[model samples]
Target: GAGVSQSPRYKVAKRGQDVALRCDPISGHVSLFWYQQALGQGPEFLTYFQNEAQLDKSGLPSDRFFAERPEGSVSTLKIQRTQQEDSAVYLCASSLSFSPGMDEQFFGPGTRLTVL
Candidate 1:
């Protein structure tokens, strides 16, 4: 019955650094999502997974952004060649189902990344 969780609450990276962020969704949840929140902006959807299958990745900014959920519960988001523009908060959310109208998503505290 644990809630969604993310690791490395904060990260400081130099330009061109590669970083990996982790997320652990609530147990038995069927849907997981990743979002990016830039300063003073609302969170933007990055990708989504239904179980182990990545159903949508249209929101990923570039090839440098990658996400995976191999076993359906834990996920990782990786960014390569970090830039100052990439500094933002990464959030993870999970829902009991993938239905947009039925399930409510629980969000993690988010990981703040600062690229210098």
Candidate 2:
């Protein structure tokens, strides 16, 4: 079975440019998560999906950021008008638990975005 996969392992974006990062979760996974990791900092939750529903998005930093899991398997995180502060590793994870408190998520390698 394929594990979680994220595209453009690295990306360099100009300030104010929009960027889209992609993720592919494990087969049959029902839960997905998106996180942002700044240099030397632990990942912070951004959003989460259960199947095709976005169950939680309280962690999204701003209105400029958006994410979607169309069919419960693949997802995308779109950042509009990228900023220097947005430079970080965008990580995607997938799990099987309906309750986030009980799920053990498997993470992707992550897409590193650098804003210049």
Candidate 3:
């Protein structure tokens, strides 16, 4: 892909339902990241991957969330038992550099997940 792309740009999930959002990053990018943004707030990092290696998942709010990049290019973020607090815009970004200290991430438009 030429840039990061996320599917289901808008999603409405019933409370306690499970949802999966997908991201396709730019070609040959070495770093991928996921973030969550509640309305009126800045993005908060959820996880980061260096190629296929998940380096950080410190920002995921709870055990119900999981993410993977099985092939180092496309990624999925799955939320189980979604709560109203889970409603937010999920963003995916990719960078040419794997290192956090040097990478310049390019972000997608984001998937807006709403839990009711």
Against the true structure, what is each candidate's TM-score? 0.97, 0.95, 0.95
Query: Model 3 lDDT vs. the true structure?
Result: 0.94
Q: Report the C-alpha lDDT of model 3 over 1-116, residue by residue, as the tens digit.
A: 36788998999999999999999988899899999999999999999999999999999999999999998989999999999999999999999986538778899999999999
Task: List candidate 3 stretches off by more than 4 Å.
Answer: none
Where model 1 places Cα greater than 4 Å from the true spot, the runs are none
List the lowest-lDDT window of 10 residues for candidate 3: 96-105
Model 2 agreement with the true structure over 28-63: per-residue lDDT tens digits: 889999999999999999999999999899999999
Worst 10 residues of 2 by lDDT: 96-105
lDDT of each: 0.97, 0.95, 0.94
Instruction: List the candidate numbers ranked by lDDT, top first.
Output: 1, 2, 3
Best by lDDT: 1
Predicted model with the maximum TM-score: 1
TM-score between model 1 and native: 0.97
Greater-lDDT candidate between 1 and 3: 1
